[model samples]
Target chain A: MSAPVVDLPAYEQARRIRDGELTAVGLLQATLKRTEAVEGQQPSSRPYALDAADLEKVHAFINRTEARALQRAEAIDAALAAGEPTGPLAGVPLAVKDNFCVQGTATTAGSKILENFISPYAATAVERLEQAGAVVVGKVNLDEFTFGSSNESSAFLPPVGNPWNPAHVPGGSSGGSTAAVAAGEASLSLGSDTAGSIRQPAAFCGVVGMKPTYGRVSRYGLIAFASSLDCVGPVARNITDTALMMNVIAGPDRRDATAANLAVPDYLAQLDSDLEGMRIGLSPDYFWLKIFDPTTGVLEEQPISPEIEKAVLEAAELLAGRGATIVEDVPMPNTHMGIPVYFVISRVEAASNLHRYDGVKYGFRYGEDTGDLTELYRKSRGAGFGLQPKLRILMGMYVSAEQYEKGYYERALQARTLIRQDFERAFDPEGQYGLDCLLTATTPTTAFKIGAVYGDSVLMQYADMLTVAANHAGVPGISIPAGLDRGGLPIGIQLLGPDFSESRLLQIGRAYERATEDASWRSIRPIVVRNLP
Target chain B: MTKLSGLQSFMQGSGQKDPASKKTESCFDRRTASRYNDCPEGEEVLLPQYPSRQDDEITPEIFDHLVDLAAFHLEPEEREYLRKELNAQLKAIRELEALDVSPEVPITSHGVPFKAAISAPLREDVIEACPEADDIVAGAPETELRYIVVPDIPHEELE
Candidate 1:
């Protein structure tokens, strides 16, 4: 029999099954078989590439989840037949990033440190999605503790390759979520962004990733990196799926004191609303910053590629043509200070947060005979943590101590204050160019060669400069695949808005996506082969 | 006042000493005491008698007031360090006693700094399920499922 489907959204897949046009068992088996066949072939495609250990782990979950899937499917069918409660996402199968805890599943957060740890409860985001009848396939990979901008920082796996080019990186820490959505491993996925964790990867993998305003979504079950910066959102194949997932995840939760008590809006319904009077602040300041050293004085030292800028600028013009007011000179905050402040605060928090992981009451331990507790701690931490983790821990330790705390840590906090003030001042102004949202490049360039950044700390450091500020300031941001390079790799445009501004941002982003007439995102290919000898 | 710890006194002298005042101190002066009493014999020879910020303006009464104010927030180690720093400043000021001093010499303070507002939002106290603790533990080279086994500390090695 022919494979059950191709390029179908989650809601449509569920609808097909509801109408008896497709069987859940048949679809599941087809997916497993397709995954297996792809594995047997050992292909060099982007989306098809799956780590041996991770693939096995996810397959095991799939096997174990068969009964659960059947039970859920039958319930859905019964509901459809009996005219019972039917949610918009009823019976849809999905995957979620490992950063989110699902009860009965081991949420690894894509780190080896949490290898055997099982979350005792579900993340509020996951709980709501499941409550809406979405069947979670499994947890996806991510950067360790959501720290690095690239998935390569993961202690457990090499970075997820882009779905378009296996040789290129899937920008991360939400790489796995975006990859899953683009590759059709899941109809939709959930990911968290502290910096560009969600958007960067979404842009790289040619999918949609949303980071709702800082307090718009509850961060109850998501692990902390920089608490002030972190936000959880959805990744999906298109604008509608992204909205669907966002509707389920965004809301006030008592579990997270930071969660805003505002009423959740109908994100999907807001898509078609006219944005004729909306003002988008296009900061030329973003393009002027020296992200990378310039080879020539004539050309500004931009981290973004020329083609990528062309795509974004063209889109900006298109937005202007669509009756939106696009002003170019509007400046961003002290964006250059983002990296330093982010590093200090994030590392300081990381050091304190990871302190709980010392081989003790719970987790992996290290040490054999006759030594002190200090030695135990040193050895256990040394052994459990990866190099990046160690570097951050040391950096954080240095910043938190009495000596450097005054100069580095305190200064960073001061800078953060100035940056926040700058943002407030920019947004609070009235008239000609009152800011509804700020626009910028999601990533400086398209996905680069895999293992390319292995030895380059400068490149790695610059990887997050553009996106880190939004995280530091605790604002909402989203990334949509704007266009493609000659290599066919996708470029993303980032839209950052004030706190609690996701619904409007989504509406704006949806209009841009539809108006662009770009379909390079759909060209992303999943790994069709695995298990190479 | 509490006695300053050896480490505290050393740290205070190390950071707070003014180089300008060190040139005037006679090492042989009868009343000029050393802050390096805790230093090893060879190390004590290298200790410089740099001046403190204390003078007639920094009286014992003022010292007591500063100490009381600081006690609320200072850690024991910090208090000891601060006590030494205050004492050093007082001594340095008094070194000017032999010289014809003018009342017009302006005194400066430990500089107070301020930044813009908006403290970090406090994380919710509610405990949500995190990644499996055991999974994190599994990566340890030597660990029991929960606790990291360790060797006993020998008392002789205590610093």
Candidate 2:
């Protein structure tokens, strides 16, 4: 059966809208309605009466800007009626992760500290998307301060469940962004990755998430987590749509000094490029053997699950069959250092960035509860910040502290440099193992049950094990749905490219999508979409 | 002095000493008495139940110090949980120390730095009105005519 209008891919929806087959307003209304159906409202008269089962299926958004969305859609329609040239993404309904400020919307960042904070200005990336005529349906949820790998850390909202199975988590801290796209609530989403926030969740939710090379997309107005590693990128159902979304938001911005001054390329132009003559690297060391089990707190020399390994190997073989050379067992010696390096660096930056919410200005405040200024500072943060953020802050403070800086923080940074050099060695055309891109399982496993890793802080932290290397190396990474596990949960294969190799990454991802289309692998929609309320 | 000890001394020195009583009182609360049992005139006054850490392990005392350093007012249970979490993180971070990274490898504190050849255009330093100035203060819990009002500092603490 054909999918519902709301469930169509973003590019298809945009195409239909442009061809007069669909109106931007109709698409927005359908998307908003689907969103409301999935994220059912709590009964205001008796908020406590909401059923646990109902709450489990709900909560992909922190706040919905329906009025603004409809207004934007109407404007798009009016412009189309006037025969004015609309931008590439005209009439597409998208979701912005709450961390990205959207003017006139409550951008809580899934934290109580910013629960009531309305952004006075929108993020530059969001502005670019809106200017391209994409109607933002709402601000989606995320881990509070974007700290946790699971959505459980969000203090102000319900946990975002996986669309594949409501009982499972939609990997995080961009869980809601991925879940929204997977559940057909939003055609596309903008998610930030500071150590795999975008890719991990996309892997879990069976959607495409791209973390562009660091500074490739402007980080202006994006709530800073780890300034050096953070990137704003797109999450959608397919690579073409992701490429299209990237085209609009990838340019440099003067507002963000870190944004690369390099010219943005036309991503869609190379979407159909074949994998012929390309060399794809497969690292047996990291991807297959030496999996770290956070639950047991042990790093073992066992292979990954059969299904995940098969899917990754098949992806490599598929490319090989298409004339690309599959370079096997390219040793990434320092691959094990990704988690530790990311942990130290991210925590340090998170501690620094989160200091802005001291209750002295726009966010939550506790001055009224205390007569002392220091007490106000402490209490406001104590009451407003969640446990996960507090943990990260403490870790950050501890590492960056005088005693531990050399052994932990500085060493981690140096270790990060080594990790980047590892990738550089693999990507160097003149080196022994020159590669176009490296392929691996986006996550070690498919979406785990919700709360599975929530209680285990180590397990939660290790969820970014496979994806953090890209962020640490400041290269681009993309997660595309490869196949399904035994339980029918979607599995994703990741492709990591050298810095500014987004066009090549998209080209390979699109080629894989085409190769798998005949097997219905690329078309596997989450059960949530089929059973949308 | 070691940075941690230096910070500890700074924080210890900044404590509000009761001038008349010649005792160091609790810096966080005036209602509470001195945190130290035997008060010395000039020696460092440490909290009796300060969460202590050994080497890399983030002990309860060290965790508490970290909380204060980060200005996070965590509850007792939350503090305990974080104490454990921080220790685990520190343990995990030890993996990085195990790696054979040469001292010559420059630290990548920031992701790959911008190209040295490409000079970034500088914006002129000119004062301009903030369009969101009113909206910025709108979310404050308490506000005066046009400014966010924070709690008043204690006179003795200020001095």
Candidate 3:
């Protein structure tokens, strides 16, 4: 058989193969070979894909769906061959991040904490994609409990390395999903975003990822992390793929209390909308807050990259050229407290939500503690949680301390109210600074060398700084490939919309994406650094 | 004066060092002290409330008093919100303050409820295989018996 189809989008390859231009067995073989070559190249590290016997088992499972997938593919091919019709992602093979519970598959969320855990039911989002006939390859990796911004927090698995620059981190806790899509291992992967888990990796790996409005999609089976901030979204090779996936997965679930009780819009159906009359706000103050205090009119030391600033300015112009009213003089309130506020709120929720991992009812349990039960709990937690998770737990616990209540927890809550109010006032039609969507740079800087996050606190801090406000405000933020930096690493232009206004955000992104012809920004990727043990 | 271990006495006697010792001490009498040791302090204790100033210090014992004070003075909505905030903060402290639970009872940590519904469908009896097993296994550092293996855990640790 021709080697498994390697290095192509699953949908594209599947369609071509089904039309007699490619073969499924050949594609599987090539993918296996590529995975093997990648493994051999890094003899010291874990492999990126499963093995020969596992492949056989996988094939045996695929064999059950292979007939149906092939029939559907053939039908699509027949339609295409006869000048009939097909869906955009018809016959594509994709995978959902393990945070999503696919029927019968263990949804581990990348922690040994729940390695043996299986979902008796499929998540509503996964079910939607399955209904659309996307063949799920397998659950990808992630941070434990989707807790860390980097994939390293995973309790059971190694960090998901960026495919191009294996040494640099693939942004996480959706790092594996981003890596899988970027490395051509999967065409589309669904990952949860809380505090930029999806967008950060998308920027790092040079892929397209979207964090839809909170409650836009159901969280029925998503293992909770900061419930109010978590959102299930798509990561794909490009914006179109992201939009296509969004169309399938965006909706409400009766079981999810927080899910928005609104009708799901056809995301792809409106992809071609023009931004001619739309107003896109370029918040110079919001973008430059790290440097300047516009209210005080003083320059500061937040040292932003000249490279990124230039690209963002150009992105605004590009949108303006596409018939959009680009307003650059608009100012939003300072978001200086966003990161701190996000940490407190997220930790508080995390502290409360994560109390379930106690080895009593589920997952890993330690019986080694013959000591007092309290010590057993502390030791179990100290042993079970990774550094990041522990840090958050500690931070949350500290803030929630009785004496510290008003000083920290309530203060953080009040700060969140102020941030939300700022967003509301900015987007208010009758307010002083009314605007449609607020645009800002996704990252202060481009992808650095992998492992750099361990050293540079500011770099790591600013990584999610741009995305956290939306999480705090409970609004939608979309990150589009803006323009590349001097080093050719991709830069993302982030657009924030009023709550429940994801449709407008996507429209604005699509318009600008169409206007920009910077193909190089899309082509260049991260520098790979491989580590094998 | 009830008989107690050194640690218990150290904890109980430590509170007498505070200024409100007389008011706090009498309440910690034999019957109350026994129940208070394991009981959550926020829900169980009562004391003279701290002043309504936002920045006032809140001890574990003072929290219950604060709640009562809030109930007496604030509007219903205001009291409810403050109660939630206070209770949440107290619960976090209590988790830390709680002496280790016994080995038979695991210290519950993660708040995620990972339960499958009783009415949930059963897994198909026929084994379903992985389509990307080769791709997945390609990344495993070590493998044996078709499973991605790792350094063996010391069997005795059991957690």
Cα lDDT of all candidates, in order?
Answer: 0.60, 0.78, 0.57
Query: Which parts of model 1 have CA positions greater than 4 angstroms off?
Result: A1-6, A17-27, A37-71, A78-82, A291-300, A367-372, A429-432, A518-533, B1-159
Q: Residue A269 in model 1: shift from native, Å?
A: 1.8
- Total backbone collisions for each predicted model: 29, 5, 57
Q: Of the pair 2 and 3, which is ahead by lDDT?
A: 2
**Best of the two (2, 3) by DockQ:** 2
The number of the candidate with the highest TM-score is: 2
**DockQ values, each candidate:** 0.04, 0.20, 0.02
Backbone clashes in candidate 1 total: 29
Candidate ranking under DockQ, highest first, comes to 2, 1, 3
Q: Model 1, A204: alpha-carbon shift in Å? A: 0.8
Off by over 4 Å in 2: A41-51, A55-58, A289-299, B1-56, B117-119, B155-159
Q: Which candidate achieves the best DockQ against the true structure? A: 2
Interface RMSD of 1: 20.6
Using TM-score, rank the candidates from best to worst: 2, 1, 3
| C-alpha lDDT (0 to 100) for residue A387 of candidate 1 | 47
* lDDT by residue for model 2 (A1-533), tens: 77899888788998899889999999998887787777754211111221347435747887788888989999999999899988999999899998999888888887778877888998999999999999999888888888888776776444777777776678888999999998888999999998899999998898999999998998888998888889999999888899999999998787887888788889999888777889999998656444343334455554555677889999888888777899998988777788888888888888998988888777778635586888888888988887788878877887888987898888998988888988999999999888999999887777765433453455567678789988889989999988887676778889998988999999999989887889866556676666553
TM-score of every prediction relative to native: 0.72, 0.89, 0.67
